[model samples]
Target: MEFAQALFLVVAGHNDRQEHLSRARRLVLKVHLSASLSEGESVRFLPPIFGEVRLIVHQFLDRLMHDSGRPIPIFNQNAGSLDRRMDKAEFDRFADAYEDQHRENIAVTGEGPEYFAEYKIKAFREIVDRAGIEVNRICDFGSGIGNSIPYFRRYFPEAALTSSDVSERSLALGRQRYPEAGSCVLIENNRIPVEADSFDVAFSACVFHHIPHREHLTWLRELHRVTRPGGLIAIFEHNPLNPLTVHAVNTCPFDENARLIFARDLAKRLQAAGWASSRIQYNLFFPRALARLRPFENKLGWLPLGAQYVATARKV
Candidate 1:
């Protein structure tokens, strides 16, 4: 229909085809080093989203002289009405569909510790692991469809878990997928739904960045409100330095978009929320482009703003 819509379809179609995911990762890695880039690289190999989408589709289809034998999945749209760029109510509407899409993708993609190794999930896992604080109670603040829920359960089977979001539908999906436990609780549309001074550790995965900076402060406040006075709050957010992040924030392809965020700003917001970082880690050190490069970015604490930022703060 519209240019952005059609463009998204082309890109998404290629992404849906499992074979292309590896190619996409390869290209992403290739562009990382200037020495690695091909001089006469044909733009044809580029994803359809790289150029005018409809034109790419037409040309590609004609070139094939028939269907490409690839079945494209339709785009998901529960968050079309929500604007993460807005100063308020970001991701409220879209979380359900967002969670659904990602949950399925993870299930399909996860082969082992490195399944979809090039993606962001592995980074989140590392963040959760390093934030190492044990508590009887756990809370995931922006637990989308419970992707983080399963990860939490996998790591912390003994702890009681709580998952909450502003979107009820998203929370419902988390409930559906999360292992049933007599001790767990699922909450929706309720900020800081957990009891005050309750949890020993509270975390949000791949969230924070989705909220506009204005609302980001409030999220920090809520993180503080729910945890015990000295409990820990961990936030694993997107890598600001990633080229894909720049593209998505500028052109997220749907009516909704991701808001731009940086670690310094996140730290400032945390301070404004009356919290201070006990431990801050910038993770997923090597950009997917540098997969061949050893010692991922976080291994070098010298560069704090390298990729993903995971901050564990104490409630103050």
Candidate 2:
């Protein structure tokens, strides 16, 4: 890593007294997946801008560190993965029931597609900074109404952004809101209808949990194929350990706890697929007990901690 890149990562990796970074950095590998790089891929230009870009990530960290009054997200043990011991159709139907009931509120309100999207995009900007990533083709894996498109346009404006969704209705709604931002371009490409191993970054947000556990490996491996060697993929999910999150899952739309997959599970997922684990960071600190301590969650800061987590890895 270049001096500037290293500096930016260390800063982005920071939480408390730098000891947090010691733990966080273990999640964010200073080590690169050298074999994943092809002859044309080199870290030559990864330094200067990396530092400037990471400044954005630090700003995000600052905001997330502040305790939000909401209960931290929880792992909905009820939610099933593709590796189903339970009914796959029933699992999806349960989640879809929530989606169907409050389609408008869920899409336009609550976290406001843009709210979560903006926060998540900022996080990825940090990952790209550390990964020395520059992509020509990108996939917004859980492309929700194109909220993530702006982030890609701002950073990799020239790259083709392929937005995918299981539901066309959602994409249509997305186009209506963010037309100029390539919400429309997504339809021209394929999501369920398209071939695999196509795009560069298989950027996902809050979508993996909906996928049954059995299919996680296949889905990730397919993502690995669409990109060129050494490509980067970032996965964003709620932290099960957070406080307010617990409340959101039981009371909210899905009636399923946001499946907060542990970081260890995340590591196994990446390592199994031949990708080197680069950086996994904890964003929101939403402690579970804070559910009852609502008024105090934000004030205590250190009390109910971290409901959001991010995993950024490379496809080797």
Candidate 3:
């Protein structure tokens, strides 16, 4: 098929304003798939940007197909060249569901911390500090609505920042709210679009629980691929051991389907992904009523009953 024909085939269903962008992303994915399969043999035939865009689309398609319980059509084609499973209708449903919800409710102001502050951003900062990450390049993986940007900046102001997420709308707002970010990537899949060994410290807060358990390691490997040797990977998740955390996620609109992961399980996933010296720390030991107790909470690191816990490991 012609390039235009393939692009059109990839974006056939969408008739909205985003159809153009939809086609663009698919094209990136196609070119990326070709280059990946052909290796350097296809470099002369494709653009350099294909390498980056393919990672995003490949990840995106994996999520969509996995969710739809069907295979996406893109892979069946020569460019993707995998299986013959084709279900555009199922793909559309998954795509729509993946879009951002509660856009207005998730906003953050430059004057104050955003919605995540209630979870004690200070504890997250403490985890990064404890990880001993050098203040250089930082990647905020699954950076929903850019809520983590402010805290990341506070923790490593001099570090170059990149915020990545699946929802373009969320990323758009993230860029608007935090212009200091050098790159805002719209990630559709488990893979991060950045180059390998690109980040000094990579962090994701409350993102993994949203991902299916089966895909966790795949994404972790992606995180591992992009992180520099000896770089820190910090993963923060809701503590399933905490009843209050369960109640909150059950009630939260965005988290209706979230499966809160335990600290040990997450730590194991990190260990299996080739991360070394893995350490887990529980934080947010106090409710807002006991906010004053946060200071004392630091000394209670021995306790793993906090509302959330951060799993840190070095990419060795």
Candidate rank order under TM-score: 3, 1, 2
Using alpha carbons, what is the TM-score of model 3?
0.63
TM-score for all models, in order of appearance: 0.59, 0.58, 0.63
Off-target runs (Cα >4 Å) in candidate 3 are 1-115, 118-121
Highest TM-score scorer: 3
lDDT of 3 by residue, 116-233 (tens): 5434345655665766656588888877666666666676678888888776766776677778766887675456777899988788877787665666888888899999998888
State each model's C-alpha RMSD to the native: 11.5, 15.8, 20.6
lDDT of every predicted structure (CA atoms): 0.52, 0.55, 0.63
Ranking by lDDT: 3, 2, 1
Model 2 compared with the native: what TM-score? 0.58
Top-lDDT candidate index:
3
Kindly list the per-residue Cα lDDT of model 1 for residues 10-113, writing each as its tens digit: 34442264444334333433433222244346654766544543343344323222234322111222222244234233454665566334434333222332
The lowest-lDDT stretch of 10 consecutive residues in candidate 1 is: 71-80
lDDT of 1 at 139: 74
lDDT of model 3 at position 111: 16
